[model samples]
Every structure is written in structure tokens, then in C-alpha cells.
Target: MDSKAEQQLASIANISNQKERTTSYLALLSTLFSSQPPSKDALITLGRHFVTSMSMAMVVGRRVLGSYVIALCAGTSMDTTGTASITLDDEGSGENQQFMQAGINAFKSSEGEEVRRDVVEGVLAGGNLSGWCEEQTTVLRHLYAHLLQLEEDWLGAAKALMQIPLEGGSRLISDEEKLAVYIKIVRLLLECGEWGQAQTYFSRASLLIHVTKDKETNLSYKLSQARLFDFSARFNEAAQKYHEVSFDSAIAEEDRLQMLKAAVTTSILAPAGPQRSRILATLNRDDRVHSSLPPSLSTMLRKMLLEYIVRQEEVKEFEAGLEDHQRATVEGGGTVLERAVREHNVGACGKVYDNISFEALGNILNLDAENAENTARRMIEQCRLRAWIDQPLHLLYFESRSSHDTDAEAQGTAGGLGIENKEKEVEPRLWSERWDDRIRETSIKVEALAEQIQQKGLIPPIPA
Candidate 1:
């Protein structure tokens, strides 16, 4: 501190009455900043001593004086330096702790909210987090987060909430509290479309979800999980979770219907496979699809369930309801919905044709021959479609099976092109067996030919 500031602090520290000392202290601070502002280091020095003196005054039952002193020091520093960062040596750590606690305590009073808000904002904005006690840090961050949320800055609010140490803080945290904070963080990040980061917090929440009995916590956890899956393009899992959450009695009817609709949409958008097909069957079987959902979604669900090709207009209507992430292009050159639709169409074609030319398949799928071939190849490789490509003939030949067997095969292991079980050992066919069958067939034909000749008497009696 400068000579003048030090003298002022020393002089105020000696006053007998808390109110008189506090009044003198505030006047001195006002005078210092009336014309020329103090240097950063000088202002920090004054702030530390100011906190110490005010806290001591409060020990004598002058809390109101201490609160004003706390507010004045923080405001003066911010006005002078446009920042209120204060650094303390190891010896002065306690003073720093006292300073933060005083600000928090003052914030709890009826008339100190606005002033204490400035103090919290200044401290969080520029002060080192290590200098504050854990309880103080948690309280201040929660306050700051609430303020950020009021501004609708979701990303900022999430970031602020993340800084509140959930583990190993001086304040004992309950599992319920931890879960609630994690859920709130997840919800905020999701609002800002930060799914990647949201997943990290959701994973943390999931670990504690079963341990807590809070219904609101469980509901939030489930909803966040579904949204995370949906954003990550795991639409099948997303659909299942959404459908499950939609049945929660705690949710209102309108909200439940919204979630059910989401389930239907995601189920349709999921990659066409046995897993997706099963979900589709479940949804189609549900009376709610016909009663609760719109006609367009219900119709699309029926067409997909029965393996009928979906129309472009139907896809367009569905696309309008998709989230940004759902509409995002995948590794290949199309939106997620496009890929799902194309794969579904390929599966549908397997139902209708034993074999189809690549050009014809492309025309039906509204894609070029190569693209259609590629799409079919992917599903076949994934064991989602029971089909093979005759590369030399540019034809797609589907392996026909009974509907029961088809369902079983779709549910089978994803080993190969839904053709052979590559993982299991198989005996090779012997060339000798093949030759014996061929020779027998030839002999029968030869005998028949001889009989015909004898009947016509065309062969002379050469055998006799």
C-alpha cells in the first residue's frame, strides 16, 4: 500500500466505536478515488486491509457497517482498475478467505443484493479461485450462475456451475445435491447445443442417478440421456429412452405426447436394422401412434414397419421436425435422415425383389446406381439386410427367407453380409460328391435316350 493508504488503514484500525471507524473508512476511500484512482497493487492492498478491519468491526456487533465496508472496497477497486483481483501471500490467505466470506454473508442481507452482486461479479471475474475457501467458492459460483442464467447465457451459466467443486469441498455435498447440479449442468449445456460437453456431465450424473430417490432428478436424468443420444446420432437408443420417459406419470400429458412424438421421429430416423425394425414394430403396435401422434408420423411408421418404400414428400415432412444435429451430414455425403431412408428403402427392396439391376435400384431409391449399390453393400455388410451383390452383373440378389427367419436373422450376430456365419467353422463341399451326383444324372439321361432309340428301332442289333 502507498504511504497515505497505510496511514489511513492504521488510523481507522484504532477507532474505538465500530460505526465511527466505518464511517471514517468509507470517507477516506471516497476521497482517494475522488480524482486520481489508486494503482492496482495499492487498491488490492487497501482491499485486504479493508476486509480485515471491517470483519473485526463486525466482531463487535457492527454487521451493517461491515457489509457496507465490504461493498465499498469491492466497488472502489472495480471502478479504479476495471478489475478487483487481489493476490495474497501464504501468510495473508486467511485475510483473503475472510474477504470472500464477508462478501457472501453481506449478500444474504435484505438490502445488500445489488452491491454484493457487484462484489461477486468482480471477484469471480478476476480473482484467483485458489484463494477462496471451498464453501465460499461454491456459494459465490452458485450466485454468479443464477445471475448468468437470468441473462439467458446458458453456456456461461453451465461453465459457472461446472466450477462448483462437487467433490471434496468443505461443504458436505449430498448425492442428491450432486445429481441435481450435474443434471442442471447437462440441461444448460444441451440448451446451447453443446452435446459433446453435456455428455461428460451426464455420465457423471448417471453414476449417481440410481443412488438417489428424487423423482425430479430421475426424470431430468432420463430426459437428458435421451437428448444426448439423439444428438450423438444413436437414434435407436434415443428413441427407446424417449419412449420410456414419455410414460412417466409426473410429466404432463402435452409433454408426454411431445416425447412420444420424438420417439416416433427418432425411431424412423434410426439406421434401418433389426434393432430399429423391432422398435418400429413396437411403435406401430402401440395404439398411441394412431391416437396420440399426427397422421403423417403414423403413416410413415406403418410404411417403414411393413418394409414399404417411403415417399419423398413423407420424408420432407419428417425432416422439418428434426433437430440440427439430426439434419447434419454424416461421414458419407448426405443428412442422417437421408441415409436412414435410403437404407430402409434398400431393406424394402429385399422384400419385393429376388434380384434387381443396380440402375433400377438406384432409380427406385432416387440415387445413382453406384450410390444405391454402396448403400445396399453397407446394410448387407452390417447384417441388417440379407442380400448379396453380383458385382459382375451389377445386380443385387436378395436372400429370401420367411418373415420369421428374417426377423431372427436381423436379430442374429452382426458377423458378415447376413449370408454366412464367418465366425463358425464350416465343412468344405467335396469335389468327389459333386462328381458322383453329376455322373448319376448323366447315366439316367443316357438310359432314357437308349430306350427312346430302341422304341423307334433306330439302333440295329449291334449288342446281340
Candidate 2:
């Protein structure tokens, strides 16, 4: 830093006003990096100072420290993915690298993975932990977990986070902070597509968030669950959850925008049905989408959605702009949009055409007669489409009623649910049905436990 800059920092640090100190620090960071970027050595020095200073206060008084560490972690993006990022983001790579190195220098040189661990171990060996309060210990546990991430032991870190102890029945964190921790773990699991573990942590997060009654955390946690559902191939469920989350006032504009986009994307991939139609319809009339999204992106989403719900026609111009991955249908055997269109067209025919020729079906699904016939067979077999393809007559017979009642009854659905119907089903069981079953099961178990208490004369029972 320039001499003048150092003098400014000195003068600002001397100020006793909390707000002024904060403003000064913000200004300092901007000034320091706004000019030519600082060297690693300069960042290391600054980082060591910050780490030492913060540590002194935390250890001397044993503050909760989560806020300080969390702020530091956020600046470095360590909390974003539950791992220390090896490379810096492109847009602000230089400035971010400086910030990240500062975080690193607090415990270790930029090159040493064992930096935080060593500092923490030293603190523990010195009996520093013995004096720390639960919240303070919580901070150390979080720090140690993050340090494990720098070593690429992210799964281990997640396990450690889950195991952060309680002295009695109380937890070390506030309700909101506890929810945040669970969200962090869930996101980290999502990074590596660990759907099972992500689901587990998200389930816990959903429970923790209920006690606070904060709409923002509630909506954000729903977004996390939606992402997990998306990965689990529960597209329609994810789409519905994303749609709900998008409309919540508590979500930030950026996240809400992304949530809306995801809603449109997943809605297309959801099995063709009235549920899909409802999602698309909701998105179509929402003026917020048009006003909030970029013109090109809004147009693309609209075009893709229209292609599924109403027009399953040729989309060459639209397809031209997509990248190879977008064009490729790796998830369900066709490009995502393509699968949506094909599936929609297949389901739409039951409503419009009771008996259509293979050639006509092909035109609607954007396939050749032979290919369309094959697709119809696959869908019928999978119980996604309620129809039969007659090769001899080169025709498809769309049933007027339940196909299962016919000579060639449709088998159970793709996931062993009931047959596809005229209005169409979303998934194996309606989400509501699943919840009802869970609640009913819980009620029965509770009743059984109550009976056991009364029958066995187990400890004093509650009033009737």
C-alpha cells in the first residue's frame, strides 16, 4: 500500500465509531485492489494480520465467532461450495485471489493445506478449547471442517459438521444459523451429485427452518430441495417446488429469477400432463418473467415451452442456437427440449386423436412414421402414453377411457404407479398422496405408542 493509504488506514482504525470503522475497511479493500493488484506477499501479510487480530479477540473473550468466520468464508467463496476453490472466478480473479489468500494466510501460507489445522491444533494443545463456550466451540468446529475441505476431504468435513456437539439438549447455533449450516452441507453434497446425502441434509434443514418462521429461509430451503429433486429425476416435483419458491417475496431478485428459469426448464422435462400445463400456464402469464429476464432468454424460454404445450413443430431456428450439450438428450434419450416436445405430442394425441395413422403421428412428434411408431411402443410399454401402435394397419389407437380395461391393458407406470390416464398423472403418486400417507403412518405409530403407555402403565401419561 502507498504511505498515504497506510496513513488513511491508521487514521480510520483509530476511530471508535463502529459504522465508521466498517466504512473505512470497505473503502480500504476497494482502494487496495482498485489500483494495480497487490502481490501474494502483500495479501499474505494483510491476511496474517486479520487472522491474528480476529483470533485474539475471539480467544480473549470467546465470542460466538461464527459471524466473523462466516464473513471471511463468504469473501473467499469457501462456504458457497463447501470446499476451498482452487481457481478464482474469472470476472474478479485478481481481487478475489487477494481476498482468498488473505483467508488462507490467517492460518497457513497460501501454499500450505495444513495451515488452519495447525493453528487449531495449537489452540487445542494450549487448552484454549477448554475455555471456549458452546458457540465458540461451534466456530472452531466449522473452521476445522473448512480446513478439511482445503485438503479435499469434503465428505469428511460434511460428516464433521453434522457431528458438531451439544453440551446438553441445546445446540450451539441459533435457529437461523443452524438452518444455514444444514443448507451449506446440502449444497456441498449437491456439488458432487451426492443425491442421497443431499436429500438427507435437506430433510434435516427443512425441519430446522420451521422453528424460525422466517419466510426467506423457508423459500431458500425450498430451492435447495427443488435442486435435489431435479437431480433425483423427480422433474415435475422439482418444477412445482421451484415455481412456488419463485413467487415467494422473501427470495432475492437474482435467486427468484433463477428459480423462475428453473421452473420453466424443469416444467418442460416433466412428463406431459395437466400438471405440466398448469406450470407452463402460470409461467406464461407472469409479467414479472418478461420484465425480469433478458429479452433473448425470455424469448428462448417462451419458445421452448410453447414448443411443448401447444406446438410440437419443427424448431430448427431455435435448435440452431443451442450448444452440443443442450442439443444432446443425455438425460432421457433426447435433448431436454426434444424429449419434452416428443412426450407432450404423444400425450396430446390421446386428447385430440382417438385413432391416428403412423405418418400423422410422426408429423406431430417430429419423427418419421417408423420412429414415431417405435416411440409410441416405448411410451405405451412404460405407461407414459395411453395408446397402442398397430404395425399391420400402421396406426395408433388412443383409448377413449382407461387402457388397462382394454384387451391389451397398460401396465403400471414407469415407477410402478397406476396407468396413465386422459388428464395425465404427474408421477408415481401425487405429492399430496405421499404426504398423506406419511402423516397417516405417523398418526398410527403415535396411537400405538399411546396405547402401550396406557396398557403397560408406563410413566405418568399426559391428560386425555
Candidate 3:
């Protein structure tokens, strides 16, 4: 056997428990190698052998073997121009119909467009006046584009494109031509909410066609898939896919930013029950959720994640407290234990207040003295411990002019009044208000921090 064949055989042999398969492939490779300037028949035989072998390997869960088989198949030679873009004109003759049918069949079954294009080009270049080249070329290009759009048939389209002859074999169309085909396919699938299927096609097309290998194409495809998954309530899958495309090395920074935006937006909309939990778990496992994003973006996402966790914990605690309060109120019926429990809960609230250094809590109580004073006091304590207000607060305080100041102004007095005017402080009531908002804000912070750790860890995005 030739050195290449021997190397392939050795590589196969090294894989676990595939000696028999390797030997069989080696024998086939040797047979093909023996034929100098190998005949088309010999090439076809080798190709068939490799395809069958690879299919079997996959069935046996030997992916490594399958990969090798695929490599062999990729290197195999077939009729480069099987589907000639030539239309034979006949005056309403059955032969014309037959020719058209043959051409269509060849187009459908052709393994790769580039290969088919080669065959067709060779036939046309042979100086044969028998075939119609112009009509066939146009029709084939259109068919190529159309087939590429079908989500379920993308693999077939890729195989077809690879066979097409470019330059002399098949015409080299514009990037717009290829893009138009993909766009049509994606739009159709998207409208039908077949995002997963659409994405599969989009990715295949990107890999197969050079024209589709752009930042816009990748970003659009990934973002669209993310949206579809998000709408379907598949948060984890959506987030994972988003991370893959958004942080890809091939993608430009601007595109990455756009992807990040989409990812964050989708994460926010993700349902907070089991779905969010699963997504977070997946993110942790993949290390994508915590990895290096744009500095500003990383900070934001980390903050979000941290805040989310904190809010979730707070909710659980509150729910537990509520349940306990209800149980005690119902079972104790004015008993000493019930009173003691109530007192303990109230005292716990006070302890929380003493921990905060900010006087904003006091200010809130003073403003809403009549109705919100007691609740405000309880919240002040809760904010100190549970609200995580350890960082500098960014709240805006609004103050009102005192009565003396108004009187002094009316009297045309420029001098200052003895009493200072008080400002209305909008302190973030950490322990009270809409539960959803609190949870959302906290989650955002946590997610942001988690993003930071992930980037610092230097982890790759998880594969699909």
C-alpha cells in the first residue's frame, strides 16, 4: 500500500477495537492505489466503500472512525459535471422530456455542486454541440439557492453545492446570490417558528459557502436562533447557542456586542422557575455564563446574576417567613409561643435596621410619617442585612423649601432662613415593593459577577 494509505490504516488501527475495520479499509485503499491514474470506476468504488464504512462506524458509536471515513469520502473523486447546465431543444419530443428528467435526477442525487459543475463544464468544454448550456445554468443556480433555503434539506443542499462546478465547471455567482438563498430559507423557517431547523441550515450554509462566511450572517443566524428558542421557552438551549455565536473568535467585536445584548435581553425574559435554574446550571457547567465579556458588559452581567441569586433567596426567605407566621397565627391562637414568635420576627426586623450606615431609611420614614413610617422602619433593618446595599447608593434625594424660606421670599428677604429645607429621599426600599423588580435587579448583578469570573477563567464557549 502507498504511504498515505498505510498512514490512514495505522491511524484507524490505533483507535480502540477497530482492527478489523481498519484492515478492510486498508485492503480497499490498496486496490484503488494499484490503479495508476485511477479510473473513474475505481474512484467511485472507493467512495462507496468509505461512505458505507463511515455509516457503520456512526451506528457503532465510533465517531472517531466515522470522522476518518468521512475524510476518505471527501477526498474521493466523482463525475465533476454530472448535472450539465445544458438544455437540448427538441420540437415537443419525448427525448427532450427524458433529457430534462435526467438532468433533474442528476441535480437531486449529485453529492456536491462543485463536482457536478466540473462534470458539466467538462462536457460543455468538450466542443459538443448536443447540449443546451445557458438554460440549464440559470435553472441550476436558482434550484441551488432554493434548495439551500429549505431547513430540512440543508445538508442535501450543501452536498449539492460542493458538487457544482465553479468557474469553468459551474458559474461563480455573486455573494448576494448565495446570501439571498440563505435569507429566503431562514425567513421561511423563522415565520414558521422552526428556529432550530433554520439554524441547522444556516450553519451548514455558512460552512459550505464562502460568501456566507461573514459577521452579519453568523450574528443574524445565532440571534435568530436565540430568539426562536427564547420564544419557545427553551432558555438553557437558547442561552448556550447565544454564547456560542456571540463570543466566537470569528465574530467581530461589534457583532459580539450585539450578540451580548441579545443574550442579556433573552436571559431577562427567561421564565424564572425551572427554566432559569436549568439555564444557570448549564451556564455554570459550560463556564460560558461567567467568562470574559466586554469589560462594561462583564460587569453588568455579573451584577445581574448575583442580584438574581440574592433576590431568589430573599423570596424564599420571605415565603418561608410568611408560611411560619400563618402557621403560628392559626395554631397558637394567642398562646405564649405565638406571641414569642411574633416578637422574635419583629425584633429580627429591628436588628436588620441597626446594621445600615445610611440615614436614608430614617429619611423615608420621616417623609411618609403617617402611613409608611412603621413599614419603612422595618424595611430599613431588612435592607441592611438582606438588601445588599453595601455598595455606594446612587439614589436621588428631593428636598422641599421650608415655610420660613417661602415667607422670607415673599418679604423680599435675601438672607437665609434659620431652619434648613428637607429633601425627599427616594431610598430603595430593599425589603418591600414589587417582588419581581427586586428579584430581577438582584439577579442582574449576580449574573454580571458570574460573567466576570467566567472570562477570567479563560474558558471556551460550549459546543452545540
Candidate 4:
């Protein structure tokens, strides 16, 4: 056997009961290192050997064996690109496909799909690079990332992808490809509410991708920025970013519309009046909602929310379009129709009724007086509505303005939906303030580019 095979054997042989694990690794690595042609049978047998080793290793708590398997797989790559992406489902009858299919059939009659998935997961869990050589570390990480992906473990997948050193074969994986995959996995975690783990990956993807100047990458960075705000509950900022995504021609229309709706929906949940009106004005001008194109459910629902927020009177119109599931997606575990009615009441209360008893408020909102009070309390607690519920009087005092003014432009409104505070505060952000931010960011980028040029001696350094 070659030095590599001998080293692999010695590595696993230290374990208390190394016979089973040793046999599997020896056969696999022997085939991998042999002078003979790299056959499909050998590759398939290696996969089965990997499974047997892992299953036994897992039983004995000797997952260290799987790490060696990862190293072996790294050196081999299962020759997968030549075989794996082409599944039996594909119509092609190429030589590689036939061989891969034959391999699958061979495995199917022995160890089923479930066992194979378990083996992949075991390798992923055990493939840490604590003692791996420098070259093999990159190869191992590339292999590990795919294994994690197969198991749908996005967080692990992102970390493994980033582990590939830039100088190796792994570096051939461009910033574009790596960031795209990394961002996707992070986004999945973000959507699934795994914030603690997801946040680290998001920041990593952002810092890495930001230095690249690709339009698609920039869009991805922007999407990540939007996700940060959305997940953090910075409604106005999140909505603004989502709105930007909606208009980006680089993104698909279907994706853009979903983002647009997310923008408007989150906007409605922003402080009422000018903040909402600003988003509403943008949505109002976005004739896509009223376009003659085929309406996806998200587009249709987004339009419903848009109309409901702007009109603040058509509770029935909005409710009419909702299916049971859509209606049930309201915050506080209430139906959308129910929430819409409460929102209509809040808007109406802000505009028409300054201070009203709970029973009367409920009548206007089409709810019983007690339920109205409870709903108002919940909405108040959630900061959804600017109001205070008086238990003694069974009354709700609609707040003159949102008690907090975080977004600078959020303070002002011309229409009678609520108070009109036109003075822009330094603390809050308006569209003009956001534009200034853009200019500052652009200036920074230009300065950075100039510094890069000067450092390379391409041009004389600028005087301080």
C-alpha cells in the first residue's frame, strides 16, 4: 500500500475495536490509491464501505473513522461530478449515467436510501479538520460542505464552504459561487427563525461578498441587509430594503413581488401615517399590483394588504379575497380578517374618534366590546397600534402620535389619518437622510478604490 493508505490505516487502528472500521477504510483507500483505473464499481463500493464504517463507528462512538472517510472521499470526490448530478431520473443514456444507474441499482438491492442518508449525515457530523493536513483540509471541507448540504444542515453547510482555502482547488470556487450558496443557506436559517446561528453566517457572507463588485453579488448583499432588518424588527428600514429589492431588475419578478409585498406588509406595521403613507405612496405607484399579469397568491395578498392599509375602510374587500390559511397568518394568532378589522378600527379611531368607550369602539370595528378591548390591548402591547386601553371606563384613548419616533420621516403626515408633525427630527430617518447615506457610502467606495490604486503604485498617492 502507498504511504497515504498506510497513514490512513494507522490513524484508525488506534481505536479500541478497529477491525470493522479498519477493514472498510483499508478496502476503500486501497482502491482509491491503487494504480488500476478508477472504476465505477470501486467508487460505489467505497460509498458502501463508508456507510459500513460509519454505522459501526457510530455504534462504538468512534466517529473519528468518518473523518478519515471524508479525507478519502476528498481525494476521490466519488468522481461524483462525473456521475452524481445525473440521477437515474434523467433521460440521458450516457456511459457515466448508465454506470451511475448501475451503481444505484447495486446499492438499492443491498442498503436502502435511508441507510445512505444516515451515512452521509454521520460523515458530516464527524468530518472536523482537527488533524487533517493542509491540502486535505481544503478538500475535506469541500466534501464536508456537500455532505452537510445533502443533510439540509444549512448552518454547517455555510461554515464548511467558507473553510475551503482560497489557494487550493477550493479557491477555484469563486466568490460568486461560494457567496451565493452561503447566502442561500443562511437565508434558509433566517426564514426558519434560527437567528443565533444564522446571524453569524449572514455577517460572514455580507463582509466577504461586499468587497466583490458584481451586480448579482451586490443584490445578494442587499438581500442579506434586508433580511437583517426584517428579522430584527426594524420595520421601516426592512421595508425600505425590501422595496429596493422589489425594483431591482437583476432579481426575478416573482421574487421581487414577494419582496415588495414583504416591504408593504412590514411598512403597515411601522408607525402609522407618514411612514405608512410613504410606503403606501410607493406601493400605490407600483402598478404591478393592478397589472394584467397573472396574479400569484402572494401578489394578490400583497395587493389586498396594500389596499386595506391605504383605504383603511375596506375590511370586507380585503377579507373577501383571503383563503383560510392566508387569513390565519395574522400576528397574535388571530385571523387576517380579524386583524384587518382591528386595524380598520385603529385607523378610524385615530382619524374619527379621539377617545371612545370600548363598547362603541368594538361596534365600529364589528367586534363585541370586551373582545375589542382585549384585541386593542394585545395590539397595544405588540406596538401595532398607538393606543391605551382604560380598564375602568372600558375605553381606548387613541394615541395622538406613535409614542416613539425612531424613523425621522415617520413623524409627519398631511392627511387626517392622525397627527401631522412636519418637523424632521435628527434622530429619525427620512428618504432625504437615506439619500445622504447613499452618497456617503459611494464616497467611501471611491476613496477605497483610489487607495487601492495608490497602494499598487498605479497612480501618485493623494495628499492628506
Highest lDDT against the true fold, candidate? 1
lDDT of 4 by residue, 384-450 (tens): 5666655767777775655454332342434424445554322333547655865999999999998
Candidate 2 residue lDDT tens string, 1-464? 23554466558657776555654554555444332223333332333334334323322222112222332343332443222112222433344445544444443434333434554433323332332344444555576667777677777667667655532534334566667778877876776667698898788777777776666556667777888878876778887898888887776788788888777667656665455655565566578768876564456455444433345333444455443333445543567667766776776677667889989888877678888887777777666665655567898877566444331122212322333435444233354764586599999999999888889987676689
In the predicted model 4, the residue pairs found to clash are 327-336, 408-428, 408-429
Q: What's the residue-level lDDT of 31 in candidate 2?
A: 42
TM-score of 1: 0.69
**What TM-score would each prediction reach against the true structure?**
0.69, 0.51, 0.25, 0.51
User: Global lDDT for candidate 1?
Assistant: 0.70
The true-versus-predicted C-alpha distance at residue 30 of model 1, in Å, is 17
Stretches > 4 Å off in candidate 2: 1-137, 145-160, 166-179, 294-332, 348-355, 359-371, 377-388, 398-464
Q: Compose the digit string of candidate 3's lDDT tens values, residues 124-168.
A: 232322111322433443344333434345544444444333335
Q: After superposition, how far is residue 112 of candidate 2 from its true place, in Å?
A: 10
Once fitted onto the true fold, the runs of candidate 1 whose alpha carbons sit more than 4 angstroms away are: 1-119, 129-133, 403-464
- Model 2 gets an lDDT of 0.57
Q: What TM value does model 2 have?
A: 0.51
